[model samples]
Each structure stands twice: as structure tokens, then as C-alpha cells.
Target: MQTSTMRKARYLLLAFSSVILTTGLGGCSVSSILKKGQAEQKISVVPQVLEVNGENVLFEVKAQIPKELIQKKPVYSIDLVYNYGPKMVEPIGKMRFSTGEFIYENDKPTITRQYSFKYTPEKSRGKLLATPHVAKVNKAGKRGKTTEIASGVITTSKLVVKSNTVSLAPDDYRKGVSEPQTLTFFFDEGQAKLRDYLGTNMGVLKELIESNYKTTLVEITAGHSPEDADSKEFRLPLRRAQALEKYYKHELDVKSYTNSSKSVKFRVMPVVRNWDRFLKQVQLSALSPDQINEILTIVNSNVSFKEKERQLAKLDSYEYLQLYVYPTLRYADVRITYEIPQKKDSEIYLLSKKIVENRIDSDKLTEEELRYSATLTPLLSEKLKIYQAAAENTMKWQAFNNLGVTYIQLAQQALKPEIREKLLKEAIINLTYASHRNPTAQLFYNLGSAHHIQGNYLEALRSYDYAIKLGGRVEMLQQVFADKAALEIEIGQLDDAVTSLAYAAPGYQTLMNKALLYTLKGNYQDSKTFYEEALALKPNDALAHYCLAVIAARTNQENDLALHLRKATQLEKNLTAKAIDDPEFRAYVKTPVFREAVK
Candidate 1:
């Protein structure tokens, strides 16, 4: 059942990779990669030559044949081994042998030769050496029997010596060369010896065990192999490797997005070698009802990035998401204190975000494997040194945004208004396009804050309004209420200010103003109580202190008026201006203490 599901996953993965490169402005490119085509191999090496000049005879020669040969530089070498038969030799220069052009400019035959000379008969022999050509007898047999002479094979003129074709295989490669992935999983070939696999992949298993305790990270894993246990053994290895990858994902229960809510999807790359096995495993020959159900369940479970984006995009509240992909390595046997760096984790977060946001994005990645990108390119740090360079380079757009946002937030929190304003402006410019192009509530809210700080009230209001429209959660509503109310009060729209501030908490400065409203209505007792309450919460409420003094004087409360008058004077030193100008404080306008304080 698992095998059948894995086969389907591989088909889907291949299909995604083959999706033609299409641009938002342009249609699919001329070279639309067909999902149907297989992963064609490149020229692994070129023909080489080797020589062990010992005897007059050449014996064996070996060539580095291509597992899957494409366009390669046609080149061959003549390996001449002394005292050996003629053999072919593969060429070697700087370790790698091929130039990747099949047609060889220099067509030459590899030749090896051998020569033997007898001094007496079979027992008595003279040693002979081999040269570029056929070995020739320098001396005749000394005994009555003429000296028996042996020769070697010679090429046209390309120096064909005796063939002792012994291939010099490079240092032993990893056990599984085709799949150079760091994450590897082993099985009992076809058995479910869970304990054995757990013991074998000690590190993965240990990590998996620890993951059981961490609920934040939702892990998903699928199982696959090059071959099927129930079927032939040829493709089981690939299946096994995929199965392990899936297992870790499943055991870890990785959270699929920033919200840490949904389950991570499990997928497989079964019989990754060919599509025939891929198809058969997904759609097996007629099976029993239960068997078919199990197969379907597994097959239907795998999810793709584009598919995930589509699914998650359906949520109206979910404006943005991030995907994080990482390849972590662990030594099962060794104990090491290695920590995944903050920068690395940040990268994962950004990558994950891109994956989640890929729905709106036109360009989609095929597989999780990153390309080596050998084409001439500048180092990443160098490329990011300037804005122009960063703009010119598009590959690391996601990375740049990640770092940019972190810096932008830091700038806003800076003590220097100039620095804060500069960063906030840049942040708004960058994030405006980011959220506008893709649309995220968080980015919009930040833009609103920046604009508001820079005194672009209307623009700030617009941004805040849109951000709220995009995201209508309670927390988001709070920001809008606070900003709008403060702005209204600043512009002296006291009526609107009172209405807006109704939603604000009493602990705010608006409470002092609210107390004055009661005093304006000629409610002396209420004003006195409210001012006292405001002072109790914030003893340095200067406006409240001054208001209390005026209310006391109007009520003819000698002790209260004197105390509050002195208190307000101490708190505001500038209270004289308010007492003389404010109509509500007119009664205290000529108090001797107030006059002396002002003088």
C-alpha cells in the first residue's frame, strides 16, 4: 500500500519539475520541459590511458564507461603494460576524463604488447622490455633451438603497447552514488524491523525521539525506495531512501507554516530510476478491495508546493505564509555539540515562506534539491553589498527580503528619530511593493505605522484601513482605534475625539481630558472625584492637577483649591498660561500664587 502511494508521489514530483518556465508577462518558453521526459544523464567522464611499464607483455586495460553518456569530448588513451596482452586505456587528465563532445578529433587505437625471449629453452630466458611499438627480439636463441620470441599488439602509430588493461577506479564512492542526498534511510531491504532501522539510523531516530516532545514543529515524512519489497529488488534502494526521508518528516510532525497549525504533508519519490516502476507502483494490477483502498489513501496523501499554496490560499484570513526547507546532517555514532546557526534558521524560515506564498508567484521550484549553479556568478555577500547589485540579481530575492524586514523593524525601534525615520521609509517602500505585489496584512500594517510617524496622516489612515480590511482580528482592530483616536484629538476634533476615545482604556492620557469634560458641564463633585482618581493612577497628571485646582476654586473648597493649585503649579510650571487662557480655569485666572508663579 505504501509502495503504491509512493509511486504516485514520484509521478507528481516529475510533473512539477517539467512544468514549462512561464512568466507573468510572457508565455511558456520555447524549451518547455516535458514532465514525461526522464532525468537525462550528463557525460560523467572521458576515455583515458594508463601504463604499467614492467614486462614486455601487456595484459588487461579498462575504460571509465558512462552509466548514461550524453555529449562528451571523444578522447581515448593507449595504455601499454609490459609483459601483458594488448588492451584499451581510458584517458585521465586532472582526475575528470571527458570534454563532453562525443566525436573525438583524435581517433586512435589503444595498443599493448608483450615480448618473451628464451636463452636456452623453456627454463633459461632473457628478460625483454616493451616500447611504443611491437616488441622485437634483440638477440637470437643461443642453444641449438632458435630463441623463442614473443611480441605485443601495436597501434597504427599512436604508440600502441602491450595491453594490460587494469582500470584505475577512483577512490571508492559513497554506497549510493546516484542519490548524493545527505539524508539516508535503511530498511531490512523488505522487512519491517523498526527497531533495527531505529538502531541503524541512530541520529535520525534520536532526533525523532526528541521531536516527540516538541509540539511547535510539525514534521511530515513519506517512505520510498528504488525497488519494491513485494516486487523485484532492483528499485528497492531508491524506495528505501525516500521512505527514510518521509519517516523523519512524519516522526517530527513538522509544522507546515508560520501559524504552526496544519499537519505537514508526507510524500515519496519511489523507484526514482524510471517511470515504468513509478506507474506500476501507483496503479497496481487489479487488487482486492481493502488493498485498493489502502493504495488510494496513500496515493492521495502526497502534496506539492503549488497544490499546498492553492489549498492554503483559500483561507481569506491567511494573507501570507512561509516555507522552510533544510538539509540537516547527523553522525549516528559520534556525539557532537553542533547547533544550527540563527542565520541558517532564518534562511529556512524565508524559504518556507516563499514556498507558502508560491501560489501567487508564477515561478515554481521543482524539487527540494538546490542546484550547484556553476555558471559565472558573484559571491552572495558581494552581490548584496549594494542595492543596485541586489536589484540586478533576482535569485536571492527571498533572502534579501528576509534580512531587509529584520533590519526595518530594528530601525523603527532605534532611539534616533532620523535613523528610525530613514529605515521606516525604506521599509515602507520595500514592503509596500512586497505586500502589494503578493498581499500580506502584516506588511500593510507596518507601512501604515511608518506613514503615520512621517506625518502622512491620510496615507497612514488609508494603509491602516486596508490592513484592517485585509486582517480583521481583534488585536489588529486595537491598533486602528488607538491611532485614529489620537489623530482626531491632535486635530482638536474633541467631539470625535471623545467618541473615538470611548473605546480606548481609561489608563490613557484621554482620561485626564475626560475629567475636564465633566468640569465643563459644571459637575464640580464629579470633576473633583475624577481628578483625584486620575492622580491616584498617575500622580504626575499635570492637566488633571490644574483641572482639580479650578474645580476646587469654583466650588469654594478652600483646602482642596489651595492644595491642587500648588500641586498643579509644581507639576506644570507652565500652568499659568492655561489658567489665563483656558475659559474653564477663568475663576483661578487672578489667584496671587498663579500670578507670582507666572511672573
Candidate 2:
């Protein structure tokens, strides 16, 4: 009976709860209140895709807050996610804003932001998309970490980037090699005027100017020997330079270079005592190394320049220095800088004929044209005739040297032994005259080449050494070393030949020669290493490929040997015969692939 009473009480309580549900608390529940509050607060995102300039892509987006949300005083942050390429997606830079920072008008807030990647102007190659997200700040004055709402893709653009092409040509194809020549004019004691030898050197200088496409600058610097009085040292050099400048302007009547663009510049260098030359003389003298060191220590002290000079003057060996060094420092040096542009074969022929015929128009003929025509004409006879005329007219050292070069070329190309001998003799005579006119490194180098061809090995080596000493003009130093090494090899001085190439320029040609030398010494591994280095420097070098093919054959690398041999013969047809007879390829000569490759 007690259990039944408890059951009856529970049913009455349930009936009361049903009445409360049927009735209304303003006809709304707890969930309905939350939903209504959310509906009242409104925030949205506006998206845009824009092209900035012609090449840049920009993603512009804005956050909009209605008056209702602003009145609610809620803070929010704007965030963006973007894609740079088809497969490249990353978060755009972090961006946040509060209602207070936005421009407010009539209780509404507006805020904007932008993001950019890079520009590509060639092909449409990439995609860019930006999606914005918004988060509300809580009452705690901290941003809510969650992204409550997000906008659609704000920007999408394709990328276009152009490709660049590069080109490489061998050094052998390079034309218009520029060489620097020095002109020295000596002066008597207290004399700043030109000397008799100046006429000869000046003629050479004028010829050089007339031979270039553009005479850039003529630097005339004068300096005095240390023997002059301290007060006179600076004054004498300045006076000498001023006199030379005056001579160039008033006496020489060279208005074109002076008036053109101030191409002729004059400067007075400080009085040069040739102290380095003095040191060399001291070393060569009977003085001991300790004595030389002591002298240098005094000369190189931190004392004043005058005090150092006084110390040098007080040295016991000053008399020997006076005799060897002082005389050479009293001079003016002329440095001519000019450009020589490359010319076509037809242009060279036309210019050569014009030069030989004496019909070259000074106004129309460029210095490079005159130079190329006189030097690079195809026919040796034409070059000889042009240079012969140039020699007769200018009577310059360069003219004779060029004439000799033409003869040397003619001799090299001549088929008949007697004609070759005669041409070689003529070259020798002309070059000897050139040496007398100007003892330049280039002159001696040419003479060395001529003597080497004539089988005078010792004379050739001596000339080569002298040329190397004087070859401070340009990039010709390495070529001289290369030629000297070739001469050394001819005389069977293999070790000296290798030593001679120590200073050879790091180029494909020199590296290839080094590879050959190593191969001759039974160093196939080292030979292969150097050959690979040469090929890396110049991929299109046929000789490097041929040499590498030879090395591969010797090492029993059949595949590499065949591949390189085929490539070498393909690049240079004449290499086919060379590959056939090369003792290095003797083993490969019988291989079917090697036979087919050479064929």
C-alpha cells in the first residue's frame, strides 16, 4: 500500500511539468534566446581580385561590420590564407583589427587589407587565391583564436615569367685584340723640352691612335729623378708635364682629341727615384743579402719621406745607385688607350684595298677599320701590300712589325720550300728593323715565333724570355707562356715545358695542353681530370673532346671512348684521321664502335 502511494505522487509531478511546457516564458526557450542574440550580431567579408600595374597581382579584402554589431561593441580580427602557385598554399601574413581602429560612419565600421606574391610576365604559370577569416574578441580584451566565419577566394591570377638565353664563344673567335704600348721621353738636367728620340716614339704613338676605332685617352705623365733638389722635384715634373701638354695642344695641333671630349689628359706624377730599380741593382751588385736588408730597413722606416731620402743618400752604396737608377727616372711616359672593334671579312677586304690604293677617306675610315684591314685581310699578299704602304708613309715601328707578320703568314701558307724560305728571311729582316724602331714585347714575341719556325731553338727561347719580361701590356702574358712551352717541348725539355706553362692562363686551351702533357707522362688519371676541367670551361672544345677520347681509350673505357670519339670527329672532321693514328687509341683501333666512330 505504501509503494502504490509513492507512484501516485510521481505522476502528479510529471503532469505539472507538462503544463509548464505548454505554457510560455514569453513563448521562448533558452536555445531560442541564444539564437536570437546571434542573429542580432552581424559581421561579413567583402572580397576582390585586382591587378596592380601590368605585372603584379594583388589580393584586396575588406571586413564589414553593421551598425547592430558596432552598437554591440564587439572587437574582431581579419586573417587571410593564400595560394602562390598551383601546388603552393600558405597563410597570408597575419592581420588583426579592432572596431576602434576602423573608420566609423554612422556607427558602422569598415576595414581593409592587401597581400601580394610576385610578378611573372612571360607565361601564365601560377595561381593565387586569398581567403579571409574573421574572429571575434571576448570581453577579456584578447582575440578569440578560432575562425568563426570565412570569405570565398578573394583573388586568383596566373603568373607569366620570361626565360633568358645565354651564349658562349671560344676565345679563338675573339677579334680585335687590344695591346698597350709605352712611349718614354728622356730629358736633360733642368730641361723640360722634347728630345730627338721623341720624334720616333711620337710617330709610333700617332700611328697607334690612327689605327684604333676610338682613341679613348692619352695619359701623359711626367716625373723627375730623386737626384733633383727637394723643392725642384715636384716643380720639375709639373713643368715637364705642362710643357708636354702645351706641345700637344699648340705645337702638335691635335684639336680633335683635345677639343672632342678632353681625351688628352696631362698629369704630373710625384718625383720617382726608381727606388725599386735601385733595390734590384743592389741585389745584382756585390752587396751581401744582410747589407741589402739593412738598406731596405732604413729606407722603409716610418720616418718622413724626406728623412728616408736622407737616409738613402747617406748609404755607402749610394754611388752605385746613382749610376744605375737615377738616369732612367727623368722621363715622361705616354699611355695610349683605345678600342678596336671587330669587322667583317668583306669590310676588311674593302678597307684593305682602299688603304693600299691610298683612297681611304679620313672622315669615313674608322681606326678599327684601318687596323683590321691592315692586319686581318685574308690574302697575305694584300696584307703585305697594305702594310708596305703604311710603313712607307708612317715609318713607324708598328708598320714594320705588321709587314713582318704578313710575311710570316705568307711563309706559313706557302707550299714551295724555296718561296717559304724567302718569305721567312724577309720576315726576319723586317722584324729586325721593327726591333730597332721599338723594342716592344710584341715585336720580340713575333720574332720568337719566326725564329722558332726557322729551327733556331736557342734564339727562339731567348726571344721568348725577353718577350715575357716585356709582356705587361695586356692578357697576352698567358699566350706568351703557352708559346714558350710549345718551344720548350720542341727542344725535348719536357720538364721545362711543364714549368713554362705554370703561369699559363686558366683557359680551355691551356688546360687541354696540360691534359696532353700529363698523358705523355703516363698519368692517365690526372690527364682525365684536367681534360674534364677543360671541357667544363668550354663545352664545345673539339680538341678537349678528342683528348678525352684518347684517354678513355687508354683506360679501356669502351663506352666513353666511343662516345667522345664520335663527338670529337663530329665536331671536327679532321680529327677522324688523328683518332685513327693516335697511339693512345691503338687498343681501340680494332673495336667495331671505334672504327665506326672515326668513319
User: Best TM-score goes to which candidate?
Assistant: 2
Residue 281 of model 2 has an lDDT of 38
The TM-score measured for candidate 1 stands at: 0.29
What is the per-residue lDDT of model 2 for residues 146-254, given as tens digits with 9 covering 90 to 100? 3333322211111111010101111121246655445766577667776645112555544554443355555677766556452255577777766666665553344
lDDT of 1 at 219: 24
Write down the lDDT of every candidate, Cα atoms only. 0.37, 0.57
TM-scores of the models, in the given order?
Answer: 0.29, 0.42
lDDT of 1 at 178: 27
Runs of candidate 1 with Cα error greater than 4 angstroms are: 1-431, 434-443, 493-499, 505-536, 540-590, 595-599
Q: What is candidate 1's lDDT per residue for 1-599, written digit by digit as tens?
A: 99999999999986766662252112222122111001221111111112112111133322232222211211222122223224422221111223442332224111222222211112111112211111113422111111112222211111111111111111211222222112233234354323232214333344323422222232222232222332244444344444454545554445222222233333343432232322242232212235435534433456642343344345332221111000000111111111111223344334433443443231222111111111112343222232222222332322233324534545646899788777667655654543443223344555566665565556766665554444333443444545545544333344654554554444534455456545544677875776788788888866676667667766876566667767777787776554555433445557765555445
Instruction: List CA RMSD, all candidates.
Output: 41.7, 31.3
Once all C-alphas are superposed, what RMSD does model 1 give against the true structure? 41.7
